[model samples]
Target chain A: MRTLLASLLILIVIPATIALGIVVLDDRNYYFISLLIILYTMIPFAMVFESRKPQARELIIIAVLTAIAVAGRSAFFMLPQFKPVLAIVIIAGVSMGAEAGFLVGAMAGFVSNFFFGQGPWTPWQMFSFGIIGFLAGILFKKGWLKRSKALLCVFGGLSAILIYGGLMNLSSVTLFASTFNKEALLAAYASGIWFDLVHAAATVIFLFLLSRPMLEKLDRIKTKYGLIER
Target chain B: MGRDSFSTYHPAVNFLYFAAVLGFSMFFMHPVLQGIALFSAAVYSVTLSGGKAVKFNVIYMLPALFILAAVNPLFNHAGMTILFYLKNGNPVTLESIVYGIAAAAMLVTVMIWFSCYNKVMTSDKFIHLFGKIVPALSLIFSMVLRFVPRFRHQIQAVSLAQRSIGRDVTQGNVVHRARHGLRILSIMATWAMENAIETADSMKARGYGLPGRTSFAIYRFDRRDRTVLVLMIVLIAIVLAGAGMGENTMRYFPSMRMKEQTLFSGVVYAAYSLLCMLPVIIQLVEELRWKYIVSRT
Candidate 1:
């Protein structure tokens, strides 16, 4: 009940805070709203962990998965937008539960950006990747998403890239530009489609090659060490 | 790696300086202010990186600036003053062209500041600042940061081993090369998983995440750090307050209007310049001091 209430509070607080944030923060200081949204997302993530009391072993696996998701970017440097980061993140989510997935996905964006550069986009990256991971985990847990290779690839190929790239395009319009013109937003999204498609194709490739093996390995680790359960 | 003066300060001091300068550069869209911010950041990047700065400016920064400036006038056609008509008969406005240039400057300045950040704030320093407030998080962050480099090194070794067996990425056709690369990656993944388990075991052995398990830190809020901190707060407050008052604000919509230079805005600009230059100045002073002491001998 407490976990449910905390999740409820988290959901309620996000939109409320954002509405309040629009009123409070100026356009110039709008990244502060992004930060607020990031904080809002973290409330649920932290609460889930707090309630579970995750052991040191579980934390380490999550950290390692996040590390792979981060380091996964460098592996695909030769191939533009052929990132295994999202694929690795989704695999982690599918094998582990939602909370671990969120942590790994959020940390992947967070850690990688420290290498790239932090901007207003950082929090958005974190939130999008985190949510994608969270949803994958939840779906896997509820048996809505099968553990089959084809199913995972299909789900990941369709969702993670579009959501992540699409959301980032929306943020580019909101954060960088002065006016929030729908026409401008649409143009931005349209321009971003090629990159988004490239990312989606990459997601499909990585998921095809690595999803089953990675998931099996993660499942083994969870059972062997009594780590995170899906 | 340890060449920069900002590295010597407390993590809090280093982080605060970058945050303030970056925020100021991004939000303050005044043309003159953008130039100042860009120039100051360029100077600092050169100081930190020396001759390599020229190469970076040419290879990365210049192209980015040009692309950004050129791209804006293409789409955004909002202003009283139309600059030119595109081949499609769409009006390209003077305001967008100007806004494009300013945005480019802002982007370049922020990028330069980040390069400076990369120089000064090492992963350890980043972890150090937040380790206390969020122990688990900092641990994971530091670990992940560590893994980026480690994974790179590991891939090198794996590739070398693969090359010896004629399974090298370079030795094959496009399809064969990709297969070899994935083989290496698959190995790396397994290694990463095992390595993480070993790491967890080590931490468990060390009684990490235990109640009252204290940590030793090399960073402290020293006297110099205190002064830097105070300066950071004061300068940021003045700049933010000035921005809030619309002192340095530049509007580019129906028309372009530069903010009139009030006394308060002047002070804010001076404070900002000093704030941005503080790292460069500290580095300069240290260099001069070293030379003087050597000359005395």
Candidate 2:
């Protein structure tokens, strides 16, 4: 309980506080502050928490996995035609319950922004990714990760990208609505749709190519490490 | 790493400092105010980080400039003094250009100030201030922030390992690179899944999200913090008043007039900009004092 509370304080509370701070201080500085908060505070805490609870090998695995999920999402920026984010998010959902998946997805977005920088868009990114991961978890519980149900995973990944990107565009419209007309909104949405389509398509392709092998490997790790609940 | 430098601030002081800088920036919009913000942020950077900070700020400045250039001209088309005509015959007016410059300046100023804010406001302060309010959320935030760079480092390590094994994705063609990237993603996904399970089990075992949880804070509100908070409140009040009174309003459309920079306006603007720099100033002073004391001791 103590550890969980501590993790909560370090992860969600501090970031949100910093986000609020950024908002109250200067909307423009939102990105910088948010990035800083993540870099200076959250990263170190994760290391410490993992080290302290080494006996909880599962939690340590989760921390490392969460780190990989973050790395995968970040890798998306550097690699063309790659959708590491969707793959890792789905993996998080399958392993961790819905809340855990949501947190990982949200944190992945929030923390990755440290490299990309934070902005007014960070929260929306968090929310969008969180929802994606959460839904993945829900679907996983319904046996979505099974080979027979693999197409559903692809659809889920695509839906997540589309929804996240679409919502992000909507938020941009809201922010710039004072200066933007319907034409501007339409243009923004149109441009955004193209990016989202690419993102979604990439996610689907990546999942299709990789999910089976990835799941097999994960099941092996779970078995080898005695991480499987059975 | 200097532990004192990283973990010395009380949460209240840090919070006040953050609020002061943000409130002040929002309130001050005049050239003088902007200048103050720019100059003070520069000085604060120099004091807190010495020469290294200036070089660091340059990287952040590039984006601010790009954003200003891209955004200002697109939205604002109101100006009287026509500089040139586009092929489409739209007049590029002086007023719009000036507004663009001002907007750019504001953006840059905010960026610099934020860089300073980031330097001064440590994670310890944030953890202390928000630990109890929402523990689960805080933990998630801290863990993510904490893990991201580590995650980056791990990715680099994995990439290096792959290169050592003669599977370097960097040297591949587009399609090969895509496949390699997928392989990396698959590995990463497997890792994330395992980590989530571990974290969940640990949290469950540790009784996370228990009712009536208590947090331990390393930061304390001292006299200096209190004084800073009071000053911040005063500065915020002044800045808010200025913003409320339209002293910060810049007219770009129709004609360019600065609304006559009054003495009152100047003072208000100065105060606001100073408020923005307050945290940086406080941190610098504290660091210097600590340094002096340590040297003497």
Candidate 3:
């Protein structure tokens, strides 16, 4: 019942809210409305995670994963677009459950922004990273995704391109442009396509190389400490 | 820079001030209101961080303002009075150019406000504000913040250790360097996982997740905080009243139309400026009082 309600909130209520906002408010106010929507989407995830009352070990594991992803950017400072954040998030989703995945991704986004400087884009980044992790976990649990390198890499690339790139570009349109015209949006996407491709390639590369060992490490930790036992 | 008097107030006061200012600055596109907000934000920021804020405003924000303003009229071709024709034959409109400047100024103003916010609202204050509401997530936030620096330190140590063993990230060709870097990361991950188990055990032993767990905080909302909070609310209410009267905004679409400036609008602009400049004003008053006492002594 809770899952059904959450799904309903995401599907029916959110779009309705967006449509209402568009009709009622000025189109120039897209930034505020979109930000509120992004924030609203995180509510159910937080509520569910809190309701579960996860164990200390489970919480610690999630915190550890999030911190790793946020701090992992320093490892490749020389390589501009290459980052291990999404790869670690995907591994977290595959190992832990969907809730844990979302927490890790969202927390990483928030915490990293603390270091980089928070702006209007913080919520959008959090939502993008979070939904990707949530999808990875959901797909893996449904058996549509697998533990293999080829499959995880494919998923990672597509997520970076479609979800992260797409949402961030849309946010740029709302952010920089006064009006949300098709020409402005397309131009933003056109300008950002190369950056997105690099990011996608980086994710695929990281997943290909890091997924096996990272998963093994997480599995070992879980079994050894009995973390997040179902 | 030293801790300003305003920041020494209660966190609630500080948070409320920024929230009100940021919300108002984002919504109000009236030229006078924008000018007031932008100037106050710039002054407060420079007062807060000194030279760094000046450098940031000059080097980054100034150029960004111009670029955003220039870019907006190109994309938006909405307003009436045609300034000129672009290469793409879209008529460059005066209204769009003015709207672009307003939008750019608003964005920059909000960003400067956020910069001040970051300096004032530390993570502990944020956790304090939200802890009761979202206990688990707040705990996770605190934990992650604590863990980030530690993990980064550990990664550095691991890399240094690997370097001594001739297997560092800078050791060889591209593939070898990549392999070494990955090896360091893998080692760090193993270390983090192993140590985190102990951290979790300590939390478990300390009665984590128990009912009625209370967190300690240092902030106490005193009488001064109450006064400031009330004043801020009154100012915010006045500003909202102005917004309701459409005195704080101008219609830029179709053709630009600004409401006639009235006495009420003047009062609203004053209230808005006071709301934005509250911290800076407080800081100046406090300094003056301090100097007077010191001189008498």
Pairs clashing in candidate 1? Answer: none
Identify the runs in model 1 with alpha carbons over 4 angstroms from their true place.
A1-53, A114-121, A174-179, A228-230, B83-90, B148-191
Model 2 per-residue lDDT tens digits across residues B10-93: 766666765566445533446777778777767676666766776766766656665665564454455678877767766777
Residue lDDT tens for model 2, A1-230: 65676677688878786766445433333333443443443344334433443234444444454566666666567664255666566666666556556666766776666656554466677777767777777877887544433664566556655677766776665333223345546766886776677777767765666666765776677787676452
DockQ for all models: 0.44, 0.18, 0.76
Tens digit per residue, CA lDDT, model 3, B49-135? 999999999999999999999999888989789989999899999999998999999889988998988888888888988888888
Q: Model 2 off-target regions past 4 Å?
A: A1-65, A74-83, A90-102, A119-121, A134-202, A209-230, B1-7, B23-28, B46-52, B59-67, B79-84, B122-124, B144-213, B254-263, B283-297
Runs in model 3 lying further than 4 Å from the true structure: A1-25, B160-166, B170-177, B295-297
For candidate 1, write residues A1-230 as lDDT tens digits: 76786667677877776675454333434444555666576766765565555667777788888888888886667877778778887887888777778888889988888867765577788888888888899998899988888888888877755788878887776555534567768888887888888888888888999997788777767676776344
Winner of 1 and 2 under lDDT: 1
Q: What is the lDDT of residue A182 in candidate 3?
A: 94
The per-residue C-alpha lDDT of model 1 at residue B103 equals: 76
TM-score to true structure, per model: 0.86, 0.66, 0.94
